[model samples]
Target: MELKTVTAIIGIAWASVITTSAQKITMYSTTPTERWIEKKYSPDKSPVDQADIQVYTDSLLQDVIGFGGTFNELGWDALQCLSAEERDKVMASLFTENGTLFTLGRTPVGASDYAFGYYSYNDVKDDYTMRNFSIDRDRYILIPYIKEALKFRPDLKLWASPWTPPAWMKVNEHYSQKSSGIEGTDIGHNQLDPNRNVLGNVTGFKMQQGYLQAYALYFSKYIQAYRKNGVNIQMIMPQNEIAWTPCWPSCTWRPEDLAIFVTQYLGPQFEKDSIDTEIWVGTVNYPNPDYIRTFLKQKNAEKYVKGVGVQWTGMRALPTVHKEYPSYRYMQTENQCGNAENDWSALENTWKAVVHCFNNGVNSYMYWNMVLNETCKSAWDWAQNTLVIVDRNTRQVRYTDEYYLMKHLSRFVQPGSQMLRASDKENVLAFRNQDGKTVIVIYNPKEQEYSYNIKAGNKNFKVTLQAKSINTLVL
Candidate 1:
């Protein structure tokens, strides 16, 4: 679908209202009394915590927090999953600044694994005629809902990624069954024996390093086309979850292949075309050590790609990866738990996501299938977890507990906020910003509540965190 997403740069100003009184207002907190104090803040401060801060001028937070929703998935049975009015309302909710929900996106080249079916811009019809291409599939469901959502946020910064190349581009030359986990009768046989090359899918296009370069340019053109239609395309990932190519929907590209494509092919094409969009790599399995090691080792690969996208299994490998590739941007590209055993499990996933990523040095995060059919019916053929799942029969979209947990961090913890070191003596992870603001998030996976000291600067406030809860305190 040709969904129009707009993005704007919004400014925030502190209101002028001050009261001079010794009156004390108290709320429940498990935080110790020695961790609060005023500090300095400067925009140019290296490691932000080192800057001078004007306590009164800056709030501990800024901007609306956000997550991605697959319009195709969410609006699949819109009339069934949500009333026509509720659909509009839900779409509007995404842009409400008070809800602090901002950011809209699109997959420039193709559908993601969470999608109902596999698709791309230049699908192979009869033969490989790349020039005779069109995004015909999206014209039906995904694009329409996205366009409607944009009506709410006229200035939504849109970014995109490609899940897989056209079936014609793979070694199997067919999109349906993949090598990773796809188990079905193969419609097309692997043309070559031993099919062990890192570039597994050797098609007319993806089969060669030079063809990969062409594919990059093809993507750039797609972005430009979208821009012509008023949607601003900001970034691109060469491949999504390149490490463990899934069968539901995915593609595989080894570290050397990615590096060769970036340093040798994609990078030059972007320069030649003057494509302003940034390239990210390894939209890889998050928390996986092998992918990180492989991608990081690729020759001068980091120079071209802006960030390493962590998703699914990739979440476990952040610490090791960050230590080596500290210079590149670390983004939580995709992660969620829709089918979590219970609300607590979902919240735990959120806690693990926010704390682990920030503590390990990830800057941004994105969730998969923002909304899904509660009953799990879509092209990905499988539904594990999601933030909002609507019952197709009842048309009720319930916000899971993870939604609230995400809010605690994403709503208050603004982007560009430097993650400063702080003590974690009580199973509590915390970070202090340059603006004399400290965000201490406590995760009590155990059954009992835990109280601890968060000493920083000169002032510390006594705090208490609920048992089996995630608490974020700004001091």
Candidate 2:
């Protein structure tokens, strides 16, 4: 989506009030004391514990692209159980301008650990022509959820990642990996085969001549298929996590092979087919500096890659990657899914993650799953966090504190806003919106109340941040 359209959509959605000459400052917070409370601040003076914020016009970072959550199978399944009225309410809360109004979406290209069973669109053997490719599974659940979200904002941008390509494409011919704990799988010492140079758990596609072309075509065909279904996917990645060998849907690729497929096949295919969908280089995890540097140093690295996507352990190398590849767009693709047991600390870590991702060079931030059943458990037997949880027995949909954390920023922060220079103290971030509004998000992880000052643009204010709070102030 273009910035002009983004500004128009968000402007109508945000309903930013203009004062002709002066700017308006509004505060929205998700703290222990208050929920999604909105407070209008007097920019000229301080009402409470306001601080002096200093703004340096010359120092700026990447422009804010957008915010959203993943459209996982589990999330869709949970939504399917919601009553019509409740479902509409949930959609509005996420997609409407008056609610979270998220603009970006992450989708699984095939299956993830979230799916009930392993699956791929082109499961047929020797189907290099991709005649068997179909998104029929998505139609039953995931599509409906995405389309419903589109009802509120048709321009919602989406990107997809594949957890496993296809059994026929991989060396192991296994749609999923045999992790140590999965039941009824071949039992043995699962370890990386150094001699063969393949992951023993779940080897990725055989890096052969014909397979590479077919796989690239698989992606292109998928894009065309979605467009035929009236959905436009804006970006795509080849794999979910290049380094993991999990129990469920997964494919592990050597860094060299991944880079080769992108530069030689996927990149050129997208261009040849005239597909507008961008090729982002991640959803990759566990960043080994040498691992990522290997890909970046490839011949067509600059030509094929539009951005880098990171999650979990990938955040460790985010600074180095951002510093080295300053020209490429960077995104925090997956917000770390906290333990299913939702608590104050989970919310705290989530808040810190948002700051951490943006404070680095991430232009966009995406949560893993939007909603799950009460347990927030995945098909892989592990549990995770989401914006909301639903109870199957009573058909009750309950919003979590994390939902409010998203509202704190997505509710007011506009796309195209630029992250401004701020302190590296780990909890505070400031941004300048395209509409000229200044936004400040402060997260206090401590248990005690603390007061601080944010002085910017020659205006000073004093404020007291509550303990264990997630706060966002818009000026």
Candidate 3:
């Protein structure tokens, strides 16, 4: 979408009262102590600073796909602790226009580490044709969670990725690649032989033709089954963290092997089955550019691969990969999970990540765990940060600093908004929505409040940012 430039009368007096008919700038600020406080300001007549952050709306970049969080089994399980009304309120806060207005969502195909336990749609051994595939297990947890979100925003776009393929398809024949030594988790939780914990240049999934073909069918059946259940998956990533060997549900695949799976089996099967869901290579956690290049350089990769899903260490490789394949879409698939701190520092880091991705050319950014129990402990014993924390004992919900940080962007930056070019200022982002409103987000990372002069076209305004706070200005 092209951004319409605003032509206005120049030399407007500073400190003039904004008439009702005139455009008024609204500012939303969130600090460590306060959250989402609103204020109003008129155009400043103050002299423009030489260091003013300039937003070029006419010089538009990528169109925003949207912003969202993942839907996990444990998130649903945590909500079960609340009353029906409370649960609905939480859903509304996430999916409703009155709240964050998240337009995108992600779901795991089978199980992520956040699931109550490890499982797959088809656990039947050697079901090469995927005849035994079923999504019945999701009916109890994931389906209901997603249905509630759809209740608020039926048009929410969703995508899916699996933490691991079915255990039967992997060479180790285990759901978890290795056992996490955390208390209460050990060899019993994971059956993979200790000696088989090889990492680099390994293909966890069996490289046989039957297993490859069946895995492809497994993906097809998953899409069809979810569609039958009222949830439409718009895209699919072949794997999550293709190079990581975490103790949770995970699979490692050499880039070349994955490229072959996409070109020979998964891509062809999707075509024969008439599945319109896009195929993306992703949830990549590796930082090596060569790792991604190996897959993209494969013959016919451009034909099937729609985009790249990057996160964690993979963010380091985004600039090089994006520059090389400028036409392919890119997304920040997962936000880095902190060590369950959920403090101001963590929120600041997350803000930096959001700014980095949007600045680097990602169309969309996704948060990891949207809501978790107060303990914030995963089934694999990993504690991670979340936007909201539900206290099982008290049935209380606490919105974290990160939640407001997301709201500072997602609440105002509508889907299809064009990312506006902004000066290379640290902790600043600008976007022009389809409605022609420009939203500017800035972060004050210091202990002292900072003042910024924002120049957007003929309009020049000054905003006072609170200490250690996030601010969004909507014009």
Please give the CA lDDT of all the candidate structures. Answer: 0.56, 0.78, 0.88
Per-residue C-alpha lDDT of model 3 across residues 360-410, encoded as one tens digit per residue: 889999999999999998877789999999999998899999888888889
Error of 3 at 141 (Å): 0.7
Measured against the true structure, the TM-scores of the candidates, in listed sequence, are 0.75, 0.88, 0.94
Residue 275 in candidate 2 has what lDDT? 95
TM-score of 2: 0.88
Clashes of each: 45, 19, 1
lDDT of 1 by residue, 1-475 (tens): 2233222211111121112122122222221121112222212111333322222222232222234434454445443456678876666555554332545454536766556556677765433325756665656565565667678877665667776677666655555334443334333233323253234332223547545655766676776766766566777877766655345445677666677777777778888878888887757774557766776677877667787777767777888887877777777776654443326576666666766766676766675555566655445444456555677777677766665555555444453355555445334544443343565555656566654443434433334455666565565
Give the per-residue lDDT of model 2 (tens digit) for 1-475.
Answer: 9999999988876664334225555666666557876666545544334444455545777899878988878887887788888989988989887778898988888888877777899899988888888999888867787898999888899999998888788876776555453444443233423343346333377888788999999999999988888889999988888787666777887777888899999989899999989988887787665667777898988888889888788888887888887888888888888777566667778777787788778898888878889878776667888888888878888778888888777766668788888754377777787777777777777788776676766555655677788878876
Worst window of 10 by summed lDDT in candidate 3 = 2-11
Task: List runs of model 3 lying over 4 Å from the truth.
Answer: 1-21, 46-49, 182-188
Alpha carbon lDDT at 241, candidate 1: 67
Of the candidates numbered 2 and 3, which has the greater TM-score value? 3
Better of 1 and 2 by lDDT: 2
TM-score of 3: 0.94
lDDT of 1: 0.56
